[model samples]
Target: MYDVVIVGAGPAGLSAARMAAEAGLKVALIDDQPRIGGQYFRHAGVRRIGGILAPRFGRARYIHTSLSTLGRCGVEVLNEATVVEISADRTLTVAFRGSITQLQGENVVIATGARERVIPFPGWTTPGVIGAGAAQNLMKASGVLPGSRVVVVGANPLCLLAATSLLRCGVKIVAVCAPSRPRVTFNALLRLMRRPDIFLRGVGYLLMLKLYRIRMLSDYRVTDVIGDAKVTGVITRRFAEGLPPSEERLDVDLIVVNDGLLPNIELASRAGCEIEWEPSTSVWSPKRNADFETTIPHVYAVGDCVTASGVENSLLEGEIVAISIAASKDVGERGRLRRLSRLKWRWRRLQKFRSAVVELTVKESLDQRPLTDDTIVCRCEDVSLATINDALCQGVQDLNALKAETRVCMGRCQGRTCMHTVLALLATAVGKEPDQFKPPVPRLPLRPVKVGDWLKKF
Candidate 1:
């Protein structure tokens, strides 16, 4: 059994592993990705700048040193390892590569990170439509552009970053549809002033937007994705407009939507950790104490899997959680407290730096109900809004009941892609807050794992 088993290789997981191993703990870092850098540290064959703030000059160089530290510190790294399930006794059933393996850990740190929140619209399932974050993922991981011409929609700041990257890749951005009106834009710019580094990055995006002559279609939301077989265009309308809104169509091969992100907390919830839906962020996060420990005694939640503040905060949180684990292991309480005190100071400084980022990057929800009534809310099950509405009309009061009635989230994705949309529709129909509804039931095999693979190995 290892002293610490980290479930992601992102900023948080890497930092936690390095620190725990440096403290003389046997560390095993697991990630589904093929490389150490998670989605945030995706380096595609060149020097990567931006994202990570390091003294090493470039992100590529920083990642190099991080992997070097994990190596020199003797952390056993398992790339392409998918943690399928966690048992009551802290045994992690991991599907690594072709076979499955059982890992018993003294302490488990979950840093699975976050996934893009995509609001469904008519024709969003078209071949060329993608999440703006997914578009960036494709570009960052493989040096690929999403499409020749793209229409980026939604209100998240990730739209700005993806647009900048796509432009650098020589992709033509037809338009960027977001709620960038005067008051909201001014507040974001003014609020971001406290963080000079972030302000400069925002300026860089604006400069690129100006340079490329891309339309910053302010206050706009995608009403519908207009395409038959593939993405041919998108219909955008202002959010503040009247019923039967004035629509503008933009012809493009790709439609990248960036609504927001939800913490990937399936594994944590499946492990019986308490979860609370945070109204401020409009995302459900694993409930953690001040010590960052989950409800499970030896399990800890850190990074974007807990809160998607930023990379710097995630790195700090990772270190803090590692200290918590080290302290709990009956390793000289006095010495552990002394080192934990030092790490907490670093954590405070990093948290202060990210406070402005959280304020400026809060996403606004869109009215996705009027999307022609036939939009596929759950792509995995092909469940449409009409189907959900029909179920609601048939006396489905609870969200879980509606799921049973319509098979809304009983799909392969396990409600990752469309749970929020389903919740929103039900909340509006029931005349109650979305948080008032119960969360989707958490199940074992949090991620998809074949029975044969585990039977053969474990």
Candidate 2:
């Protein structure tokens, strides 16, 4: 048993563990990855790969310090431990390689982070269409180039950053395509006007594109991808009001598409935590109070797993949640809370800039292109969109009923990927607003548990 068990070793998880352990709480940090850096701090030694960009100076140093602090503070870090289930009694079932174990904790912090959102278009499943983040992971985390010539497609500030990084690593960027208008949120635009340095970074990226002569395609989308076994090229079309159909085919070895991201809320939902759906980010996240405590007592969540906020907000939330937890234990620690209050002020100040950028970049809605009847909406079970629509037309209004009829959300992913699509289709079929419809009902074994491994639980 431990005082706190953190279920991820990313920025938020690491920050929480570092703070909690420093406060003399026994901390256990578990992550499924082979390393503790998660996605943001991903590094693959000294080998340089095409399209890989180095991290920012401050971020690099902070990650180094955090890792060193973890070692010095004696926090138990399990790198490859996959948490399978969480019980109502705070019992955690984890699978580490061939072994299964049950652990208990007084407080549990979930920072499992978020996964990249990949909206399937025609031929997206072909060999070369991959998530923008997946390309970054391949080059930065694993030291392998996704492809020599890459087309970066998405609508986030990160997509631009990824393109810049890839260009720096000597990869040829065929083009950068975004479906949304090239506009920032009003608040973000105001903040950017005040911050010249941040404003210059955007200009710098454009200058780099000009220097490299890379093409920038805004108000465009990858309508169809063409390939056989491997990607040969991509088809892009402009988005105008009933514009004439003219497809621009770009020859490319790889295509990276990032729609946005969704929080990994499977475990939280299965553990019976209340979920809040945010249409702006198109994600279902846990409902937490000002103290970062979830509806379930002693369970906390921070980082991108809670919102679409980036690394800075995640770290700040970690500290805030840790301080709140500490204050709850010792109400007399006024000094600690005071210091934390100062830290929160600084965090907010820094976040004023980042929140603006995220607000400008996050995907607010699904791809408006209608799904084909033959398109597979649920990739895990190979369930077609037509089957789901058919079920919905037959009076299956609720997600549970749809699940029973079409098995759309009953696969290994546990409805994370298909829930949004299914809900949208159901709403369209039933002529109801998506929010007005019932949300997805979560089932058990939230994390993937192999049958052989699950049998050992007994």
The prediction achieving the highest TM-score against the true structure is: 2
Provide TM-scores for the models.
0.90, 0.91
Question: Over the stretch 46-128, how does candidate 1's per-residue lDDT look in tens digits?
Answer: 33423222112127766888888888988889998999888888899889877898888888999999998877766878899
Q: Which residue runs does candidate 2 get wrong by more than 4 Å?
A: 50-58, 184-186, 192-203, 242-245, 331-334, 350-355, 362-364, 437-441
* Deviation from native of the Cα of residue 376 in model 2, angstroms: 2.6
Candidate 1 at 60: error in angstroms? Answer: 1.3
Q: Kindly give the stretch of ten consecutive residues in candidate 1 with the minimal lDDT sum.
A: 49-58
lDDT of each: 0.78, 0.77
The TM-score of candidate 2 is 0.91
Residue 290 CA error for candidate 1 (Å)? 2.2
